[model samples]
Target: MDFRKLLLVDDEEGVRRFLGLSLMDLGYEVKTASNGREALAVFEEFQPNIVFTDIKMPVMDGIELLRIIKEKSPDTEVVMITGHGDLDLAIESLKFDASDFITKPINNDVLEVSLERARERFTMKCALREHTENLERLVEEKTSRIVELERQNAACQVVNGLSSALESASREVETGSGLFNELPCLVSIHNRYLEIVAHNTLFEERLGNHVGDNSFDIYSDRTSPGNACPVQRTFQTGKGQRSRETFLGKDGEEIPVTVYTAPIPNKDGEIELVLDISVDMSEVTRLKDELFATRYKYQRLFDEAPCYITVQDADLAIVEANRLFKRDFGEVEGHFCFEAYKHRSEPCEGCLVDKTLLDGEARQRETVVTTLSGERKHMLVQSAPLHDASGRVIQAMELSTDITEIRRLQDHLTSLGIMLGSMSHGVKGMLTSLDGGIYRLESGLKKGDAERVDAATKTLKAMIGRVKKMVLDILYYAKSRELETEAVDAAAFLRETAAVGAAKAASAGVEFVEDVPEGLGEIKADTAALSAALVNFLENGVDACEGRGADGGGRLSLSARREGDNLVVTIADNGMGMDRETREKIFTLFFSSKGKRGTGIGLFISNQTIEQHGGAIAVDSAPHKGTTFTITLPRGPAR
Candidate 1:
């Protein structure tokens, strides 16, 4: 079978049975043992590639088993299973070369991760061993061939001896063996006089057969006695020398190179010939530059991204933010995202980043956010998880794109569509009333009836007023005009506005109460717009009270006063009050709760006008309870 072999050892019988089955399910040929001693017996019989043993066990513990296994088969991967209390023992197993350790009540995912790691290590060791054996055999064959071919020369004899020693101590060379295989490395032997005695094939090809030449002559900077090359340094120090040096190539070009030199000692323990190796660094330098440029490019892209990008840790703290984020939100690193982005004391409800961190799934949400400048914007927020090599989510990235303009445009288009649909029926009804009034007036005039003519005149006048109000509302919704603000006496402005509402309320049999006081404050406002806006609210109160009719005990109140630097105006009504849903959408464009009598534009324009005067409006109401609107307007221009 193409399955891996695993040995499971634990003192408990249940652990052995359960864990053995789990290992088998993971594509491992599993065998169980009740103790470390029993595990050793099975280890010899099964020769498992991996051994998972509990740290605390009878007869032999996992640490002892690990030591024994490493001594017998160093390539075998041993993983320790220990309780939380036996953590120190598990750590000690690492000293014995155990692959990994897992605590008791082991998680299956953790177990699989450990197994995969052990499998990788086992495969690497096997591959490395095979490579070493092949390399040694190749060196031996090449050495024999060189010995036979160059047997006639004395210098060749010395070169052959040095080559044999180099092959045997290749692992002790300390430099990467792969570099030697990939690059044309210059290797040569220098005598005690710093004169090159022999050289390798690449050395002869690159440095031009420098057998009897001075070793320092090959280096551009070490041509003088004041500066010695790597070979001369090795001879003087009686140790290995490694440094960056420049070599003069055979083509008369300066080549950047890394040089390594080792001293070959004589039988008397004295330094004799020095073996030198130099590697051309042209390709390596280019690769290094390319890697650096790639990293820099990615970092630049991350910093200069158009949208606001923030990397948050598992705790939802902002670890890194892009340039735009820092510029808008201010250096927000180490702060919670909600605090920095939304100005909330805690995390946002159903946060997209939190969802991504939880399930490692990408998510998106549309939200409204306020900037430091107090400008509110609509944002499309997206989140994605950042993972480590083991596929565990380490952090999450949140990207927010500003969609405020898009939402505004959509609202405008939606308002137009709803306006046309809603106003059509109301306009049709008003026109029909106007037509009836005209017919009555014509008939009364022809018959010369004074009472009928007077009644028809009153009806025609009322119908014309309704038609005029509807047209104004349509014009205001179609194009908003800039405010022509001026200083106005709060008491005078509010009283005049309340008088109109009071007459309407009295006509409908509802009480109108006013509380305007003299010398309240001068409010900086667009006089016409603010007056019209306040009158709109007062009229709404009258209409709300009128909904209850004469017997409903309806009442409407308008009050104005000065509170610090603001003028506070309140309009209240005891009528068919609104629920929470109606209150929330009352300010939204083209949203009306009234079935047919309402145009829905009065309150929207009123709210906008109040805001334009740097004022705020708050509404408090509940089902069956009366509605109260408190408007706070600045006494001066907005701060």
Candidate 2:
């Protein structure tokens, strides 16, 4: 039936049932798994062409499965299923070569699009494989033919060169010259009667002087024209003759040799004499070995090139990949270059290969690509056209050089410069405010005004607090410190942090509410860091409420509870909320909604602290509405 095989994996049975049915309806022969562990077992047995797996599952996660599957079968397409809050994980799966991702409450249109893309990729891969196999076979055939031709040409050159030299020597001999004595190989001249009328010194030394002897008489096989030697055959056929023969040497040994003969014609085009040349068999064998070794050396150099090299067809399908490319990206030949190198659904825009193929011109560009191990690399990719015998572009060769470390160092230096610039302004403003507070305090004390002195004391205390917080934030950003974790009652910790937030809210005329319940379970985290991070969120909530003004019914609340193996905390405020742009940048370093009143370091530090404890924060807010931050932390400390 040509049925397409698909494996559907999820921890939930209900999801598997519904998704499997949907897949079957779409013409797939589907198998289901409850988790990644089971999915792998099913995968090995079923060998499905496509797999749909949930990102979060028991035993093993989809990201791990994706990596394993890609290692085992780079051609298999894996699509990740995830929840709305797992967008980051979904994006991560793509780095491991996931075909595509679908969120919870999967849309039919999206699923269909993902499936179609998978099918297209699979089909293209199959076609590429077939084409590559055929090309390799053709190349092997052509190589064998070329080697044989070269060997023949080498032997023919030796014979023709010697024959031509011997012909010249014969003319010299006719002129009573002694040039015939210097020829390298066994050479002689024979007449129509097959008589060796003349012989070179090499022939006389090896086969003994045979002038006036029948040419066939020197050969171990033939002794007369009835059973002709190469010399007799050349005269009989009126053409050149080449054959293997055994020569009777002076020592009476049967020496194997290659005999070549060419008839020497007179001016009237009548054959008057035949030139003979014989090379030792061992010499021919050496020439063949040299040809083979030279070819092998070239092949080794191609395979061991430092950068990743691939030969691609006009379609951009990889026809060949070098050893290093195969080692890192798996056996990716017969796949599209974009899919294998960049893990993309289609060719990259302004692809170098495409441009090179079109114009027969070399091209180069810098691009970022993800490796099979999920590491991102910056590569300098260059492509050159490969032409056929007719000078038409048939394929393109692409070379990629890894420049990841270089790019990383450059990015780090740029970020450091920007951070220092931002910190200087914030520190300067805080120092200016501290100086103003000191001047106010001195004036109030010198005037002996009790009310003015009290006001000055409060201003000085507030300014000092801000300055102290700014210093701590700078220190935290300057270096990373390990967490010293300990277990603490979640309810008690939440209440203690809430008391401080509540007092601050009261002073600002903003109502504060606490929903911390007893027995909320224990959480393992760095107590000081976790407390400060949570307090930062609460204080921000209080500020939001105070900014909304008292008449706006400003209110802030703190709540915490245990959810499964994690502690879930919520800090919400019915106050001045934020737009999408502000919300997105809230946790970014040096990004703040408040202008002069904020240093833009509190939320950034809080976010870092939460992440260090293996926690996640989700915020939901709308302009003029309200804001809620949902923080989820594991019950146990990070491993």
Candidate 3:
């Protein structure tokens, strides 16, 4: 046992000493204090577990000290020592959380008993706290386990529902009965004595007339009467077996019925009963006759349908195709879709068929297919998820429509717009050149100088060349010709385009820089077309930078690099950028921010040319900040 430190506080020194010695002899470490004040000091220094205090003290009363000690350490116990007749003060101490009260003449046995009771109560409190903590932990663990089990049970139910539906369908087909019949079929068995041991509805309906008769009498025509019957054979196999039999009706007509027998197990695992079901096949005979008569009509509807229709199983194997589908793409039943149509050995990445089955929802997708003959076609496909009776998706019905012609029409319209815009721009540039040359010629005629006449003649020839080039561009845009591709170093292309605009940038007092990386990989594109596009972008940048003063003059940066499988070229300018409304319409035909001074064909033509090269162009700009036009083209040498 561990010894607890005990403090004895009293105004009388002799009484304090006596109690201290008694507690020390009782296996406690005891300390004595003369008054309540001294006792509190000793209590702090000694760190005692229990305090024994007298009621009356010189500076502080025992009741006050007990209250202070309890406030400081609520777990510590305090015993009040009072005079023989001071019962009121003892009661007061107890109300102030004193553990126990003892009179002036303290009984040693009562003190020991009170201390033991306090120790026992504290031990029980600790044990209860620990037990409560453990119970809470266990409850939380069991709750989580229950949630997991419920999830598993729900999954199992879905699988079991499908299994049961399939089994029922098989049974209906084997017994040759209507699945929706009210009282479908039943089976029964009897022992050698011919008692009514077991019988199904079908057996009862057929053999009720011979009831109360022996089993051997009804089946006496069969050999080996003592051996296993057909029903017994079914029991041994635990599966249903069917046999054909003819019954003579009351009017002398013969009726044919198919009988099926299965085994029923008892508690001891013995097959004590047999189940029989009889099905009438007269309706089936009529259905076969009707199917042959209408086959031609159904075939006509299947072949003439407008939609590109095909049937596929869960594995996406083609099971059937309509006439239109077979005509466009060769007969592809039983072959994988990617192999037959896409001419690939693998399924298309991000296949929508798999998604439709997993979610059991109708899905639509647009895909580009490269046919076996190297023809690329864009197709829009819609697939309907097909589910079995139990709601499990088993297959998909797909309808694909060719959208290649539509895309071509859209591209043609875009090209037409670009051609008209470019024509306006070229005409405007020519008119500006003519006006400048005529003014210079008129001034030279006043001076009578041959040099000015020669300069004017050269200017006229350049204007004619410009007009011819513009006509050629219009012709190229109108004709549907395959792209002529060649290898061109992108870095050199950017530098040449930037150099053409550098003189103009200097005259306008604007700074221009080429940041393209040297030895940047080449790209496959029409060299003349690509050069024209880059020059247009550079001219636009220089024009935007023109009016801003030398100190506030704009800056232009041209950069080119390879990003992934693309060659990216960026032309950026720190100039007066357009507002949101103007930027939105900048690429539209006849839309220009420069009013009468701009034909707006520069960016629009650039957009078309990049798109033709299988590339994209995007403009990022904000008012008063700057503008950046980025062109991304597929990376490879021109073919």
| TM-score of every prediction relative to native | 0.51, 0.53, 0.35
Q: Highest TM-score, which number?
A: 2
Q: In candidate 1, what are the lDDT values of residues 1-639, reduced to their tens digit?
A: 122988888999889888888888888888888887898899999998889988888888888889999999998899999897888888888999999999879899999999989888888888899999999999999998888776746555674576557544443332334343344687777788988776666776777877788989998777765687788788888889999988888988888899888777664456778878888897799999999999999879989988899999998999999988898888999999999999999999999999999999999999998887888989999999999999999999999999999999998888798898988988898888888889999999999988888989988887887788778888987888888777787788788888888877887799889999899967777888887888888777877876687878889999888888888999999877789899999997767776666788889999998998888999998766789999998886562
TM-score-based ranking: 2, 1, 3
Model 1 misplacement above 4 A = 1-162, 165-182, 186-213, 235-239, 248-255, 262-275, 282-286, 303-421, 431-464, 474-482, 488-521, 541-595, 611-634, 637-639
Deviating ranges (above 4 Å) for candidate 3: 1-476, 480-483, 488-490, 507-509, 521-525, 549-552, 561-567, 588-590, 596-599, 611-618, 632-634, 637-639
How much is 524 displaced in model 2, in angstroms?
2.9
Against the true structure, candidate 2 reaches a TM-score of 0.53
How displaced is residue 148 in candidate 1, in Å? 32
For model 3, how does the per-residue alpha-carbon lDDT over 358-408 read when each residue is reduced to its tens digit? 787888988777654567888898888888999898988777888989888
Q: Best by lDDT, which number?
A: 2
- Colliding residue pairs in candidate 1: none
Q: What is the lDDT of residue 629 in candidate 1?
A: 96
> What local distance difference test score does each model get?
0.84, 0.85, 0.71
